[model samples]
Target: MSSVDKQLDELKTDVEQQIPNDITVTDVKYEGPELVLYTPDPKRFAGDGELVRKLASKFRKRITIRPDPTALTDTTTAEEKILSVIPEEARVTDLDFHHDTGEVVIEAGKPGMVIGRHGATLREITKEVGWTPEVVRTPPIESSTVSNVRNFLKQERDDRRDILERVGRQIHREQLGREEWVRISTLGCCREVGRASFVLSTADTRILIDCGDKPGAEGEVPYLQVPEALGSGANSIDAVVLTHAHLDHSALIPLLFKYGYDGPIYCTEPTRDLMGLLTLDYLDVAAKEGRAPPYESEMVREAIKHTIPIEYGDVTDIAPDIKLTFHNAGHILGSAVSHFHIGDGMYNVAFSGDIHYKDTRLFNGAVNDFPRVETLVMESTYGGRNDYQTDQADSEANLVEIINETYEKGGKIVIPAFAVGRSQEIMLVLEEAMRSGKIPSMPVHLDGMIWEATAIHTTYPEYLRDDLRDRIFHEDKNPFLADEFNHIDAGEEERQDVADGDQCIILSTSGMVTGGPIMSWLRHIGPDPDSRLVFVGYQAQGTLGRRIQTGWDEIPVPNPNDAGRTSTLSLNMDVSTVDGFSGHADREGLMNFVGTMNPRPEKVLCVHGDERSVQDLSSALYHEYNMRTFAPKNLETFRFK
Candidate 1:
């Protein structure tokens, strides 16, 4: 048996020994990255946080007290009792009871009220009831993604509980303890713009920081080489953690599961929800293009079963020696800068995942504080020469100028946007401009995944900026659901009506026009002399979007009338790229991000950009900060301490 197995055998005994005989532990389980004690009386553990806390410390891992299935109150009774327990002011929108975890998820409008003052209300609920209360904020605007997740949770409760239990045991499995050093492998997004992924590992523990796909690449994604580097199978990986939900950072994760990875996937709650929306949409696109994804939707479901939605700043155990705490990345809702504490402070590495150094309409600036950071991995998407960007206000004004110019000319405006971050951001800008009467409300339409992603943005309002959050929670203002914008009706007649109609704005996805609802819109509007196409985000090289942005007059598009046929599209629409709406930090933003780092890191690694951008950013940081800075490409390993 391995040392981890032997150690777990001993650790399980220790956990049993630590608990008094008065407390009955029906079963002690090692769930992948945690040790869960199933007892008939969970209140016994809840009432004494000190006991569980101390035991977790002794084992140097997370310890969860799950009530025995036999001890859990019936769902009907539990629901009624919980509703009575929480004040009506809480506005409980939804409640979920997970028998396996012994957690009652209370999704309420006023989560603070559900929690009560100083958590007295929750404490009372727990003391009186046998379940632990996990309160979530119900968004002012409902999210289909979150609603789907809730429904899926309820439907697959038993299977999900089993998945968690098995995963917990795997994470808690005893691995050899080595306090020597760790290494990082740049799996993708190095000297490249898409497929943001990487891997970090010690002698025994292994985890994937990100497992994204090459959205812009024609044939295959930039898959990680760690499995091959280790000479073991891909299943050797212990955990898959994402910094955000962008397809470039999260698309290939489910495929990993299809390839035999069955461990936990850790990310912020919003990232989890967004991933569910994006990953499935990716497959839908694949089908539209007459190709199939490497994995099926079933794999996505399996991946979701393994996902552990952790809160930002919650120090979570994902490996035997790794404790991960996510800091706000401020790129989009629920985007996070992952701070991995490896081996009891033996080493630490921080990854800035598509950071926005300045505040945007969606979120605050990325965090600069950290207890200790030895190595920092940051995205340098806009770090090339002459990559300076315009301010957000100026960019917004320029967009309005273009929109009004198009509107005045009796033309339509087609914006190709990434459905996740860029879509929501542009929608906000349009809503604000139209609401302020800076531009006329000329029937702004949202199509494909853009509307779905927007719905998700509403559900996680807590991840948004303070000002936006306050308005949504207190004053009941949700800018995302502005009346000026119309969800592109799914009916063929309605879409054709909008296409044939007069001057208006349409927001559609597959930001790069690789494939999405944007193509048909482009096919019809592209040849229009007065119509316009605007690029708000980075148009990855080789994508159709980049071709138009670079003045490609003719393009080939799949015929929507007959999927098997293709049609050549002639470009006459005026195309322009607005600079400031990008989720990534520009050259100045990147420089300032490192400048503001508290107790600067000793080494810096840049990725998520082209060859020039990565090289330029590394050189600039190296010369300016006088720190070791480098950008490693695919399959290259950087061993560090």
Candidate 2:
């Protein structure tokens, strides 16, 4: 028998012997990193939760108890039982049943009510319906992306199960060789801040981290020419771990699936949904610009089919010899700092993907604590010596001052922001400012994918900081659902009306002014001396946003009337850049992260910045901590063991 089969047999025998006789064990199977036990009487253990906990502790694995397929109630009966069990005040939005796993998903506006006190309601529902209940929060604003993703998974339950089983077998496969040495290949985001990709390899396993794309660059995708990434075809890479949903960190993932990569992509549940939304929007923006996207939507669907959503802090085996864990990165809704425990604790490495060490209104600061870390790879996006930002309080005050100043001038405010992180941050700031009368109450237009992205954020409130989560969950106060924010969904005509009609605040995407609805707004407002153009996020070098900040008088924009024509617009708007709104850690924050890390690392590698910023941070680390430090460039390899 194969080693994996033998392992499964041993696990099954142990579980059968340990579980109570009342709970008949029908079968044991691997579902990705989890070992699921099928029983006819799952309710028996539901009341005694400690039984499953003890079993998990004894086996040193994640254990899931599910009702056997034969034991599940019919869909109609199960739905009826679920509704009767849940309170009417819960306002349940939708119920979906997955037959392969015997899981019924219940989406409701008030998830806490559905869960009940200490999960009593869930336990009762499981006992009565013979189906495990998974509660989801229905966002106040409807998100088509969330609906489509959930529906697609429901439709492809059987296919997803097959993919999970395949991945589980690979993860549990026998180890054949010694992990004598560990090496990392820097494929992208080393001396520059886009297309962040890295390959971590040992003698027995290979893993890819953050396969992204660089916008407005000649070479858009990561440096796949390295032998560690695509040398033996896409399938050679065992798994892909995403840090967040930013385009620079996730855009090119679908391309991997296009080239026959069927391996599981590990990420937070929010990251999975947000990345899907952004990638689809990427295709739309490319089509509007008359450019052919690297991959088609079919590849994106394939990617979704193969993704395995993991919660933060759950250590799961992605390969036979490597275990991965994720920590909150405090950059965006689902950003994470990935920790790799390779070769049964032979070595430990942590990759900080776009960390913001200071707490923002949207999220708590990045986590600095880890069990063990010998080598640390971190981003240095704002790591220059003079890259310190204003405090959050001061930044907010300045933003309010700017808004009021522009309002008094009888001019509109145009802010180019990233749809995922910066746009949401600005929304909170504006919502509070307007509510408190710090700034005049006016329409805050959400253009491009900002509305859809904001809707996704609302769906995952637990990922937000404690204060924000409590307000949304307990107080029922969602700042994103405020009255002043208007979702501009009526296409170009509505966007044009917002730009030309009134004095309001506009938050549009392609944060750097590279493309998207921001371009249209800029084209209309650029020559208006009364209007104010405010930048609240990092404008990458060579982007039009940066060019405008550097005093570019005239800019060329695509003519709306003609397909292959351009028009030059003179820049006369008042330009201002507010500091401290960036998601990346500035120099001081980056330094503090290393200094405050638990059991400080022995070596440090600085990445994800411009040439000077990476080098400056590496030098500072070497001098300040007296540690071995390096600023690696693309395609460079470093051995840790």
Candidate 3:
């Protein structure tokens, strides 16, 4: 047998010896990066978790105790037991039994109440049914994306297990002559702020991070040239790690699956849910525009099946020589700052993915410290001189003022927000401000993909800031679902009625006014002098939002008279850009991130920002701290020792 095989056999034997003699270990297997052991009676050691915890500490690997197939009760009895054990007040919504994974997924409206104090209810169910209990939230607003991905995981159980087993064998393979130089290639989103992709490679392993497309027409936009960077086929890729689900950071991932890549995708559970919604929406938008989509929806489904949802700070083996851990990036719902531990201990690299260094209503600020970091790949979206927008308190005050002024004048405030981050933040801001009497409550409208995205956020409240989660679970107050916020129908006939009705505040998607229901709102309100159009997020270059931000009086939009034609509309409504509320750190925040690192990064690479922002941040870090820094263009490669 090979050295890896010998090691695996010895490890299993050692674990078998260490566990209780009475407990029957049905099987001890390496599932992906973690070691899982199946037991005929997991309840024998399930009283206080001491046995499992001790075994995990001894093995020095993630260990999970799963029930053997024979020990598990059938679906009928398992569901009945689960329903009986969980209290009625918990609002159990759905139950899914994943036989392949030996897990019984219990989805509830109030997941916390279902678990009971000290997780007594879950422990009882696990002991009684012999199947591990996994509790997931059923968001007040249901997302089709969440449903599809959950169903995919359930139906393709055999396929997922096979993929994980193969990946596990690959990850644990014997290291082939380590101790070498490391290289990082910026495949996309280097000098400009879209299509963020990168490749990290060593002698034996090649991994891609953030394979996304620039938000524009496929041929017209500059995107990551994956083939050029790899020089090899997609089958050679060891893994693909997503930083977040933003279209600019995840849109092109389906292309990899469509082209022949069937490797595992590493990301947080929330990121997977969001990616499904965003990627499928990308195709739908293209189809509506009478343009061919970059990839069919099936490719997206294929991508979902191969994904491995990981939590923050879980050190996992992706490549033979690479150990990867994700830290909170605080940009969107499940965005992450990837920290790669390369070789035995030769190098450590941290890639900051669109970080917001200051806490917003939805998430906390980005995490700067890591176990080890030698090179830092950072985003500089607001790194220019004088990019410090405003304090959160002052920004909240400013937003209230803008809305009150417009509302008092009998003019509706139409804010175009990005669906993922900004839409949720704006909703909370409006909800809280109204509750505190800072801004009078109006009929707040939510439309397009924003509501579905919000639903996904609710399902993964644990990924949110601690304070927000407390308010949702403990305090029984979820700001996103406040009665004042109205989800407008994503239909033409219903939306036009809102535009013609009495004035109120509307929050719609495509923050930059690039697309989605925002277009309809603008079309109806742009020519009205009394209505106000607010831009609360970044307006990308070349987008209609940026044009209006630059004082464009007339803008071309789809002609309502004919779908095939377009018309120019005069801008008569008030236009305002709130500088605060950006999901990226300013120059000061970026400096603080580097300055606070325990062992300061010796080398820093700037990315995912405009020309000025990236350059300014790189130069500042180099000159101010006397550190080695480089801001490379797309397709540029940087080497680290």
Candidate 4:
């Protein structure tokens, strides 16, 4: 027998020995780092909740209980029973049945109502209908991306199951050799701040972390041409661990699938959804700009099919020698600090992916505590000596002051923001400022993908800061659903009308003014002396936003009167940049993170910044903490063990 099959047999025998005989076990199989046991009498098995916990503890793996196909009730009857069990207040929107997993997904407006006070309703549904119940929340604002992803997953359930099975087998396969040495190769985001990727490997396993690409730069993909990055080729990569959904950290993942990479992607559930939205938007933006996208949309769909959504704090076995765990990065929704435990505690490495060590209006501070970490890789985005930002309160006050001044001037306020993190943060700030009368209430237009991105954020409230999550859970207090906020339609006429007609605030995407609706708004507002252009996020070098920040007097834009013609619009608008709204840790926060880390790391690798910033941060860390530190460039490899 194959080693994997033999190991499965042993696991099955062990489980059968522990399970009560009344609960007949039909099969035990691996399902992507989880061991799912199919039982003919799942209801009976469910009665003893402690049984599954005990099995998980004994096996040191995730355990799930599912009813055998023969044991599942008919779909029609099951739906009726589920509706009967759940309260009408739940406002169930969709009922999806997955026969392969014997799971009925119940999407409801109030998931708490569907789950009852203590999961009594859910247990009753499972007990009465012979189908495991999974509850999902319907966002207050409808998100077509969320809806489409859910529907697509349901439709492709069989294929997804097959992929999970294959992944499970690979994860459980016996190691061919002992892990003697560990090495890390920096592929990108070392000397520069985009295309963040790293290759971590041992003698027996290989893993890729954060396959990203630089935005607005053609041919700026990670150094996959390096043999160490390719290892034998794309197919040899065992898995991909995504940290967040930012285009800078997740855009080029589809290229891997296009290049014959068929492997499981481990990420938080919201990261999966948000990355899909951002990547599709990236393609749309590229096509509109007459740039050829690196990969086809089909490859993105393939990547989605292979993704395995893992919750924070869940320890998952990704390879024979490496176990992965994610912690809250606090940079954006579903951002994670990836911690890898390799070779049964032989070494531990932590990679901080765009960490925000201080709490923002959106999320809590990034997690600094880990059980063990010997080598630490961290971002140095704001780690330059002079990269200090104002306090949060001061920053918010500055923004309010800017808006009120612009309001008094009867001019529009244009704030260019990244749709995912900064846009949502600005919304909350504006919502509160207007509500408190600090800034006059006016129409707040959400253009480009900001509306859709906000919808995705609402769908995953638990990922937000504690107070924001609580406010969202209580419907009336939800800031995102405020009446003052308006989602601008895709029609150019509507956008132009908003730009020309309103003396209001506009939050638009392509934060760096590289593309998207921001460009259109700038063209209309640039020449208006009363209008103000405010930047609340980092403007990467070479972007138009940076040029404007550096006092560019005029810009060449596509002419409306003549096809394929260009015109220069004189820039007369007041320009301002608000600090302290960034999603990255400043120098002080970076230093604090290292000092406060539990059991401080033996060595540090600084990355995700310009050459000067990386070097300064590395020197500061080495001197302050007196730890071994290096600022590695792309294609640099270091052996840890």
Deviation in Å, model 1, residue 103 alpha carbon: 3.8
Please report the TM-score between candidate 2 and the true structure: 0.97
lDDT of 1 by residue, 468-496 (tens): 87767763477876777788766566778
TM-score of each: 0.92, 0.97, 0.95, 0.98
lDDT of 4 at 557: 63
- lDDT of every predicted structure (CA atoms): 0.82, 0.88, 0.83, 0.89
* TM-score of structure candidate 4: 0.98
Kindly list the per-residue Cα lDDT of model 2 for residues 346-460, writing each as its tens digit. Answer: 9999999999998999999999899999999999999998899988899999989988888888899999999999999999999999888899899999988899998888888
The TM-score of candidate 3 is 0.95
Q: Which pairs clash in the backbone of model 3? A: 417-511, 418-511
Question: Which window of 10 residues has the lowest lDDT sum in candidate 4?
Answer: 557-566
Model 1: runs farther than 4 Å from truth?
1-28, 32-35, 40-63, 68-77, 98-102, 137-139, 177-179, 225-231
| Candidate 3 residue-wise lDDT, 149-232, digit = tens | 888888888888888888888888887855598988878788787888888888878888887776543553333445534457
* Pairs that clash in candidate 4: none
